[model samples]
Target: MTEPRWLDTEEMAAWNAFVEASNLVARRVEQQLREQAGLSHPQYEILVRLAAEPDGEMRMTELAQRVVTSKSGLTYQVTQLEKAGLVRRRNCDTDDRGVIAGLTDAGREKLREAAPGHVELVRANLIDVLSRDQLRVIAAGLGAVTRALRERP
Candidate 1:
């Protein structure tokens, strides 16, 4: 087997910082969303994704891809949203086998309710702590990581 290349001191520190910061930010977002709008992060993300679309709808598989979730996982979240009257799923007109998820008016309202606190918390915990250049670099780096992962078989 090939020998593995380990991270150097600085590289290790950067990796640790990235992991810790991500966890902390996620925890804060989870708490804020749960308290403010009764949402988990994934569910909140689902809503946000749907809201961004022109018709506020997307195929379940596409949503799963966009949300970085499995189809079953997205199905569960969408089910919960449906129970909460926050989302609706329907047969896709273009694809007989595809299901589309759409945000309801209540989902829009919930998102509006949750967004301000979420933005403020994120700003307090992450965004406001970073310079614009830092944010850009981080975004580009993470975007690259995501693209790499997605492109992998």
Candidate 2:
């Protein structure tokens, strides 16, 4: 059998950078959201995704996809939001077995309150440190990675 191809120096550096930067950014975002908005990063993402819809609503499955979360994880987060009175869920109008999540006025207000600090923290930690060209390159590269992964099971 042939030996596995290992990462070379530059590839190894790139991999390390990706892993470290992603973790740092995620942690900072989580911290900022919690401090300023009493929300977790995943919870903030759920609110943002639902807020983007015209009706401030989306199917729970679609939301799980959009947030890159598992079905059970999404359900748990939604339950927390529901308890907080920021979100509501009901049977999907078109599919009895499906669920839909809707953002309440409280959710929108929470998002509005949280967004500024979130954006500032993101920019400070990642975006502002990177040049525009760097941002474009990283976006393209990560977009490809996500697309490839999503295409698989």
Q: Give the 10-residue window scoring lowest on summed lDDT in candidate 1.
A: 28-37
Which pairs in model 2 have colliding backbones? none
Residue 126 in model 2: lDDT: 92
After best superposition, candidate 2 residue 140: deviation in angstroms? 0.8
Q: What are the runs in model 2 whose C-alpha is more than 4 Å off?
A: none
Which lDDT tens digits does candidate 1 get at residues 1-153?
A: 998999999999999999999999999899989988899999999999999999999999999999998999999999999999999999999889999999999999999999999999999999999999999999999999999999999
lDDT value, candidate 2, whole model = 0.95
Each prediction's Cα lDDT score? Answer: 0.96, 0.95
User: lDDT by residue for model 2 over 63-96, one digit each (tens)?
Assistant: 9999999999999999999999999999987898
Q: What lDDT does candidate 1 reach at residue 107? A: 96
Instruction: Find the 10 residues in a row with the least total lDDT in model 2.
Output: 27-36
Would you list the clashing residue pairs of candidate 1? none
